[model samples]
Target: MRADRLVSLVLLLRRQGRMSAAALARELEVSTRTVLRDIEALSAAGVPVYAERGRYGGFALLPGFQTELTGLNHDEALALLIAGSRRGAQAFGLGSALASAMLKVVDALPESHRDTAAGAAQRLLIDPDTDLLSRRTAAEDVPDAIVAEVRRAVFAGHKLRIHYAAVDQPPKWRTVDPIGLVTVRDQGYLLATRSGDDRTYRLSRILAAEELDEPAQRPDRVDLGQAWQERSTRFRTGGDQVAVLVRLHPSRRDELVATALTVLAEDADADGRLRMELTFQDSRHAEWALWQLSTSAEALAPQWLRTTLHNRAAAIATRYEDSP
Candidate 1:
């Protein structure tokens, strides 16, 4: 808390120029004594902080203080601004601030570079799909504070206490040593260890979190990227790895074959019917795919899957037939 307060004090002074002890205390929600103490601490730490007494008196940094923005050329600055405006800016609560900052940087650049930067900004457009945006769940809205804490734990090898809720289960608390945070399509996940077992927890499901004092030294020989790859492979291979054969009309073959599932084999008959072998992880997803294909595709599976599909089809037909 004190560290955060100290950082806030510095940023506030940088933006507001000068602030009285009473004003700083009110803004920071700290006592006047605490404000004085903080100012003393800052001054001792070579922060260029100064205090004055009486009318129009307050604390301020010495004149002509300016923060430098370096390393970005004109093109680079425009690209950075465009990228930030796309989605990262909104996700990180830096949109307006970033725009303002970029404007200042652009204005400071030379004429030619500034023009190029302006042109790039005008041409850059990030058109996110409206349908996809609407489908994003609440789990996609991870708070910045939790993300910061997760990063700190990962860097410091500290353990963390997290309150997480899985899809179906009620919310529960766990103590974990965070390994990493992964950004999926729209959501963020925390990969962590619980009593030596590793699992992924959705950041959106985290009700609360705090860093613990205990440090869990990571294995010197372990490669995090490799470990994550292995975990991903296992997840993809989990559940029923069933092989199903389907016959599709030649007209529908291209559409059916374009899905992510691997095709094991294929054959075409003279009658324009095409037979293809496919592997799937679960019956539900496979069935959904077949349903999407409608009358054009028929599953010729491990007998059980075929029978299940047939039974479902018959039931659906009967329901319609029995309805007036």
Candidate 2:
């Protein structure tokens, strides 16, 4: 709504001091012309907004001006409360801070809205660590001291040194230019650069961390989301991946998808089962996933896999044959 946009404009200017029209438009996700019109409207409504003309000039509000906007509607307040109830903050070592902030949000709400919003938030759940099958997803543990030091380096744009435990490798200390931190499904990752090359380290694998006082030699600005996506794509495509053809029971299709990295193709067979072409990280990954399904899935190709499963089944049968 225009009213919301206008209020946001005032708040942005108040927070940022001065911003060019182009910059304001980008932040507001509108056109330069729309920003100009909004500025004119604010001025007409007795707002102390002024413009400057120079190579590095833009719009600014008079220093002492302030708006008395409460900033959140009832639904917005409820949304925030619901989001705050998730476990993401705890993964980043901010559980207590999140709890305190949530209390303050509830307290600041209008009397008519406070009780209802709080009640509504209690009824909705987000990102629980487990699902219906009673299978639990373990949350990675990172010490508070380690979290604090890593966070300091990332936010302050400084160099960070860490003792990392890489897979199949001994622990070693290395220095990196901290870029940002990311969390996905309860797992935390530090995205950084070492010797001008992209590097990602799991937070759980960081045995120790130290924030260096030296400034990081990195780009002044980074699109962290895009950077993460690119790295994920590279990792997924560069490994010694394996593709397999399998006949899977209809009920177990979802399970296979969760384990496999990608589903190359899938179609329903005449037997009402699914014919799926799947890709896994490697042959072991494919075998492990298929083994979980037991008789519900059959590996149609790669005779070696079928032989391995047969041998394992024969051994199990022989072991149970003499049971009294």
The most accurate candidate by TM-score is 2
All candidates: TM-score: 0.57, 0.66
Give the clashing residue pairs of candidate 2, or none: none
- For all candidates, what are the clash counts? 0, 0
- Judge candidate 2 at residue 322 and give its lDDT: 95
Cα RMSD to native, each candidate?
Answer: 9.5, 16.5
Instruction: Residues 41-88, candidate 1: write the lDDT tens digits.
Output: 988877788877789889988775543423344333433654533454
- Displacement of residue 55 (Cα, Å) in model 2 is 72
Model 1 Cα shift for residue 227 (angstroms): 3.2
- Mind sharing the TM-score for model 1? 0.57
Q: Give, for candidate 1, the lowest lDDT window spanning 10 residues.
A: 67-76
